[model samples]
Target: MTTMPAPRRLLTIAVLLALTGLVATGCVRFPAPESPPPTATAGPPVLPGVQVDVPVEPLPSSEACNATLTLRPPAQMPLPRQMPPNSTMAGILERGRLIVGLDIGSNLFSFRDPITGDIQGFDVDIAHEIAGAIFGDDRRVEFQVLSSAQRIDALRDMTVDVVIKTMSITCDRLRDISFSAPYYVASQRILSFRNSNVTGPAQLADKRVCAARGTTSIGRIQAIQPRATIVSTTTWADCLVLMQQGQIDAATTDDAILAGLAAQDPWLRVVGPSLGEEFYGVGIPKGQDDMIRFVNGVLERIRATGRWQEIRDRWLSILDSGYGAPQPYYRD
Candidate 1:
């Protein structure tokens, strides 16, 4: 079976460049301060020797909950072939392109295809579907790379019209933003070196486990084993780096992400049953019912037209798990 490969050596070089006053494309790095940076106004202090001027905001996520609880029904709307005048769809049309926020380091979900140098993956296709629905062209999109911590803030601040990243739908997040119907289902899992004795998350007790910042996987790891020291990085690629270097015993996150990481290193393997479920949704600003409805319409078309399965087969079905379209749930 063909496996997806994220260039680990290139990624390591990018990290090194970031530390040495250069940041490669698609990777995020904080600036180094000549002197001790000012005191943090919020969240935790910067890790020793890591100079980050940005404040890390706290975003709460569910621990082990399934996604069925917060599923909201999408509104009925015409196919997005043309803009509905005076509506959110119309506003997006007037702007000439769909603005989407996502992470470029998540291998299978969204990442730069090393050979083509264009960001492409399952999430990228989802964005393309939305763009195609609106402008009759899937290429009419501007992808803004963002870190995991910036997902909600990007939506709330309207920096991105929609967020197609692998974001989970939760009641906690609903308070701040709206979500489309669940498009993909993901479950938390553990990734470790192939020869490691670790069989599952439970075995990682008292060991180090890594997850992306502002993600639910971290909380799930804590619930699985409180003694396990949790490590947070800016991206999943970073987690894979820590695992490669033996800095952490295991990396835990959605199986979708772990598969991509394992593809990069044949020596890595994912162990254990699912920790819990995650239902992915496209995030829209709070109160933007039209935008939510529009996004759902796009998802509905993808599911019904077999496009969803096609995308999965192309990018994700290579993983050990098979693919099936998620049933759309409407709260109304």
Candidate 2:
């Protein structure tokens, strides 16, 4: 009987053995994901107050549009030493005509008068005042129309005496050229069609933006909306033209420049909070202390004599009549 029962028991044991498996392994540890690159810190705080409008227009695709562009280099090559103190008007007078490198394309900072064919703007007036201080006649200025990229180089090569093209006084720029006390303050802003759904920097996620090349405005836009597609041109006017033609969704630049564009096109307006502080100053070749001092004196005189206010009122009144004239910065 014991021998007979073993056959059935053996079959049941064989079936149990076939159902067991040895494939259970211990838990695994995967490598940690790589950390992302460090991002740049935000820039300095923006200064309070708005700037005067800068006139901008659509770029006409004609030879006449190209004819208005010009580039002039700096007049006096920069020396190795820091700027010398031109503390007295007599010192500047010995040097002769005040050579000024300016942007003739920008409306309020530097632009040509359509009727008189004279280069005029707030900066232009400042340049003429410096000339008058040295030569007793504002007409003694040599105005050189220059692009943003060329302005600093022009100063380095001695092609123009000074640069007054709404040049912002930044630490990087201070390394290359000497700057006078800030005469005007501005901030970066965004310009878009009034009816557009975009309201601020956060909404620019998939938008197309335009800005002038070699300007900080582009950096600001990229910082806020890293995914945005950006287009850069040589001038703000060109950027505005592209925007107007529906080539881009937004144009970003100094608020003053944006205001100028808005004035030219009724459909556009400035949006978003100010990006960063911008202090506009005249750029002098490094080591021209004497010239720097002379220019500072002229800037002070213009503010004191109400000429600065006159220029400010003339250009800014239409956009923001409540804003008072800017205070001159004088470094002794």
Output the number of the TM-score-best candidate.
Answer: 1
Worst 10 residues of 2 by lDDT: 60-69
Candidate 1 per-residue C-alpha lDDT over 1-74 given as tens digits, one digit per residue, 9 for 90 to 100: 97446697678878887766633353555688789878867643333222122223243354334433333434
Candidate 1: the clashing residue pairs are 73-330, 73-331
Supply the TM-score for candidate 1.
Answer: 0.79
User: Per-residue lDDT of 196-229 in model 2, one digit per residue for the tens?
Assistant: 9877888788787877655656655676677777
Clashes of 2: 24
Candidate No. with top lDDT? 1
lDDT of 2 at 115: 98
- Residue 144 Cα positional deviation in candidate 1, in Å, after optimal superposition: 0.5
Cα misplacement distance, residue 93 of candidate 1 (Å): 0.4
**Per-candidate TM-score against the hidden true structure:** 0.79, 0.69
Q: List per-candidate RMSD values in Å.
A: 19.1, 19.6
